[model samples]
Target: MDAVHVHMTNTSNLPVEALENEYPLRMDEYAMIQDSGGAGRTRGGMGIAKQIRAVGPGIVFSARSDSHTVGVAAGVDGGRDGRRARLIRNFGTPQQEELFSKTANIALAAGESVRIETPGGGGYGAPSARPQPRVAQDVADGKISAEAARADYGLSA
Candidate 1:
């Protein structure tokens, strides 16, 4: 029989250095996507973006991801929905393309790249119920923008 591996969740705690050392790839970017979390009194968790570039021969990509077309779940009590996931090929280039959430066997040449943005968690309550201090802190910490604070949480400058 052939060997198979399965995961209980889409999340992984693998470090970029480990991946780069193990595979013929280079980490182009790996960071949390700002404002990707659902807005609420208790805000949802943020999503992450990871971009990898092929640096050697014979690199192929595949994934069975979700939440690309819709949020993880509907928000509760007037809370905003979570941001959806995305898989991009050659991001920031004129030939950039958005790929399917579930796809397999994408050929990657040297210098070509792929980016995956994971879905954020759903919010639990109305965004207006969130405190101004928390919103300000989020903005200060770069979790959300000042404009997002004003628009989503009704915070004033």
Candidate 2:
């Protein structure tokens, strides 16, 4: 496995947004990988989902995040491994395609989008150890679905 990558962009060549006056290479969506965090006495932190849209030409996308298959953080004390991470492109469009875990520079056209889903943290204990209130909060925050809260955490509807 490779270390987490940190990306840097040169702002001088980037096109500015008409309203915000900032480059279009900004964060698009933010969410948690539902039910991905390990279930335990101390629930693991949820993985994050992020999207970035290319608003100009000459943009290139590159990444190789593969927690999706191998699993993310490993749990302790009999806890399980967290879900894997993923990298995808064109999400809702017909062109939507899943990308490899590792990629080099690939040209990105305007209006195209790239999405990344990070793996969740591993839990420290068993699912039964998680408190009901925390499960409820996770549901409200969209970190986990109501069904997951009930099925995984044993929370009531």
Candidate 3:
């Protein structure tokens, strides 16, 4: 029988400073992906993107993640589905490339970087039921873009 590893504590992301201090890497970006959540009466939570570069040679990269090719969180009650996850190598450069969701043991030279974008949660209820004030607030708070509010929530500019 396959045994599942269970933990009572909730998982948490490490701070950029801690990660850099402990590992031979430099954090490029660690921020929330704006407007990645599904649009709905109760909008879904946003995702996170983390980019790191190898500061030293002989860095072996590996990861076991999901939501890459398919199997994303689906919405309910007419809500929109969440965005997909991604693992990229050398993102935003001439040699940027997509890596497998379950890759392991990839050698990284110094200055080469990797980016992991986590998927957002699915929304609840119909987007038409969402209030205009809440949509405006989302825009004001930088959670969603004004264009997204207009397009997804049917709000006028």
Candidate 4:
């Protein structure tokens, strides 16, 4: 698990040691990614990419939805869909990153941090629901499994 503190400005006048003591996780380094969100008719919310240097090994879990789940974008006459959330790790590696994993064993020294970049949600309705054949193709391509397609997306095998 990871925690981040976003301070709008440096007006607190607190020392770095004080801030670190207040937070649960130690901060080795931090940076913000600009303009990571996608555009849609209703305009999707902006995406944020963050890198965290873990002070210790811990578990991580995430769940997020936009128009499809709770109607964040307020579907077009009940046609809008929410954006999907993704989890990736070891980004920019030649082996590529894993989209979703139950657990990751991380060995971090005193000054090691991992990078995480989450994708923005897509538009709802027609664009959200693609052709069944394409969905099957995704299964065949290993992007998703047949059982996962049926279970997650309610698609027929």
Best prediction by lDDT: 3
Tens digits of per-residue lDDT, candidate 2, 1-157, equal 1112232122122222442255546556756577777777777777666777887888798765455566468989866666677788988789999888788797889888888777777778887777788778878977778887777778987
Q: For residues 1-157, write the lDDT of model 4, one tens digit per residue.
A: 0112231122233454665676434544333222222222222233334544445445343423232223232334323333333344444546444444233454444334445443333333442354566556655754445664564445587
Residue pairs with backbone overlap in model 1: none
Residue 43 lDDT, candidate 2, scale 0-100: 71
Off by over 4 Å in 4: 1-19, 22-36, 55-99, 124-157
Q: What is the C-alpha RMSD of each candidate to the true structure, in Å?
A: 5.7, 5.5, 5.5, 12.3
**Residue 113 error, candidate 3, Å:** 1.1
Error of 2 at 128 (Å): 1.0
Better of 1 and 2 by lDDT: 1
Q: How many clashes in each candidate?
A: 0, 7, 0, 8
- How does each model score on lDDT? 0.81, 0.70, 0.82, 0.40
Candidate 3 lDDT over 42-155, as tens digits, reads 987787788999999989999876568878768889989877778999999999999998899999999999998887767789998999999989899888899999899988
Could you say which candidate leads in TM-score? Answer: 1
lDDT of 1 by residue, 22-134 (tens): 99999999887788778988877777788999999799999886578643745788888777778999999998999998899999999999998877666779998898898
User: How well does candidate 2 match the true structure in TM-score terms?
Assistant: 0.76
TM-score of 1: 0.88
Clashing pairs in 3: none
Off by over 4 Å in 3: 1-12
